[model samples]
Target: MKYSSKNAQETEKLGKKLVSKLRGGETIALTGDLGSGKTVFAKGVAKALGIRKKITSPTFVLWRLYQIPKPGRIKYLCHIDLYRLTQSQDILALGINEYWQRKDTVCLIEWAEKIKRFLPRKNLFLVKFEISDLNTRKIIIDGVSDVRS
Candidate 1:
């Protein structure tokens, strides 16, 4: 569905809420302009996964892996950023694609439009953000049931 956030905090809250239904092996494609709250939403998901480390976009290094502190079936969080790459080959060398289907890991990719063709056809979530004025955002989520529930 879709959601409107009045500010960063609200956007993050929505992110945490959306992630509650994830059980791992899920890939989330987060897309939007810079400073559109993609990273903030990711932090919310990280918080729900019991990750304590600060969450930051992997724009330079390309990807960051975090271990779920209280691991159960979901043991890892793989966060990737493709903002710096104009071509898919630049990202393929990172071998980050292997995380797409790992049962114990949840993959979140920012600027996923860079490699949309390479993503799994199923079990994927697309979170799109749009700037709505200076402190607001319109977020749309697809590929699953209503996150509002």
Candidate 2:
């Protein structure tokens, strides 16, 4: 699906809507240029997951983990930024493979284009964002699975 956002708030709202449909073990690969509001979308997802902590870009830290409590259970959101890494082995050494191997946690990755070769062929969501203007963005979401009701 494609969504157009007039501003950061609108982009985040779209992210929240998408987050509501998310389940454990989902991996989202977010690709976009710098300043394209990728972290804004991630904040929306974090909010929908019942996380109250401040959400910040993990570009410098490489990754950040958050815990969401819902219905007496806890779920994990693993946010990763691969913009600084020059090799896939750097990711592997960080135990990123473990995140992909599990079906109980949700992983959100930024700069995903750098590691597209390592992602799974199925059950993954890829979101691409393009800056159309200073306050506008075009977001495309693909490879999302239909949730069974």
Best by lDDT: 1
Candidate 2 structure quality by residue, lDDT tens digits, 1-149: 78888999888887777775666677889999998989998888888788899988887778888877762232788889888979976888776666663566788888989888887766688989999999999999887542212
Residue by residue across 8-124, what tens digits does model 1's lDDT show?
Answer: 889888778877789889999999999999999999999988899999988789999999989988899999999998888677788776676699999999998888888887789
Q: How many backbone clashes does candidate 2 have?
A: 0
- Cα deviation of 104, candidate 2, in Å: 1.9
Clashing pairs in 1: none
Candidates in order, TM-scores: namely: 0.95, 0.90
State the displacement of the C-alpha of residue 21, model 1, in Å, after optimal TM-score superposition: 1.2
Q: List lDDT for all candidates, in order.
A: 0.89, 0.80
What is the model-wide C-alpha lDDT for candidate 1? 0.89
